[model samples]
Target: MTSEAEGRFHIVDVSSITSGSQRATLRTDDGVRIEAVYEPYTRGVTDTAVVLAHGFTGSADRPSVRRAAKALAEHAAVVTFSFRGHGRSGGRSTVGDREVLDLAAAVRWARERGHARVVTVGFSMGGSIVLRHAALERDTGGHTDAVAAISAPARWYYRGTPSMRRVHWVITHPMGRLVGRYGLGTRIDNRDWDPVPLSPVEAVPMIAPTPLLIVHGDRDPYFPVDHPRMLAAAGECELWLERGMGHAENAVGEELLGRLGDWLTRR
Candidate 1:
């Protein structure tokens, strides 16, 4: 990659393929270098851009994320990026806390790239980030035209499920952090969330007037149907309880992706 300084952010150009796809390094306002890929629409012409955020341990290059990006790109331009500490990105993961800045950087980049409308679609940890970012950064340049969160938790520190319990251990224990780093290729932050950031349930209420969609699987192993129900109750939005779906990107099928693309296009 060739790096070039651009004001407060840095960009490392990887490749610009003929398919209108390109890869680059994006520097968040917090100074974290994020690895990102942009894929232009393949099926039709559109002014919308979808900024796709992956779940924990996922990066832009991950197969599931790539599949979703390719599917969404059929409707509009797509931008997929690694949260800090994942893939080729620099810095440690804050889980979902400071990751807002990372999403903000991506949204800003999307606007600068000439997309008239920008939508944020996130899964799992990313789902919460998109919820919080849409609410907290509404006045900021990071504001998105619409938002969609798949398989997100409604509240914070939920340990009702076994998966969440293990997640907590990974975030709170040193050994688990090591496992996250080496075993999962994810580097987690050692510290806890001080003062606690705004939770997704609270953020949902603030996203009114801006279109919001909450998608959750009825068979989600991480969080039950109550999660999406809580979010929908808090916000005036659409809720889709995906039958038989599991969790996050892994469970997303082409049909669901196509429906999500159609929804974003309408907004």
Candidate 2:
């Protein structure tokens, strides 16, 4: 569905839009209307764009680090949008696999707008989504300057690791089991969503040279700290560990902000 505003462009009247915000909807290959926020730089620096995505059970305007969008727009154009069913975007979530299409849709949107250089910044589950989609972006002959993921899991098949299982039970204790029991086909809440056909770790190896940065907390409870290390070890990408940081919390830290800024500034 299109927005009510003129020309399908509506300004979001939220704090998230400090300077300004414009809306656009991309129709995915699966016929889903994916909603995206176009945060263009006001200084005519339109060549660069960052596609920001949120974690599972998170919103397009994820309160976690919405400011990052505003921060990035000052540098380049940024697009912070939702996966299907996660926010204003339409359709059901197919875990992170099918959601790759959502990321591709947003990338295409940026490219069409004359953004020759684009990067993706995903939070949590969104991290995994960005990783999966980055490969597709490369395969399609698109230009993705960089890809960064925060607190991402290298493997969602979290079945046997003792600590992994415990926390998994806590988060999904009330509802996750039910979703799993029904064999729910890789929905957003389903941890097994979009198992990557190959492990997420396997996907990591392909992210390098395209400029992949894996940002993880030293003490992320959801996924083991070693997971990111394993990811780093398996791939040629940069693994940036945030000391005393855990998962989404790192997004708001000064160190993270600085590192992110530096990374963006790099070629």
lDDT tens per residue, model 2, 1-267:
224553323434343455566667677777888777787785676577888877765655665546777666656778888788666777766656777878887887788777877888888778888887776667673446788888888887575556557546634564654553344322344445333455568788777678888888877767768778887898778888877776663345754665675586464
Best by TM-score: 1
Q: Model 1: which ten-residue window has the lowest total lDDT?
A: 9-18
lDDT string for model 1 (190-233, tens) is 88799799999999999989999999999999999999999999
Q: All predictions: root-mean-square deviation over Cα? A: 1.8, 4.6
After superposition, candidate 1 runs with Cα above 4 Å error: 1-18
TM-score for all models, in order of appearance: 0.95, 0.80
Error of 2 at 171 (Å): 9.7
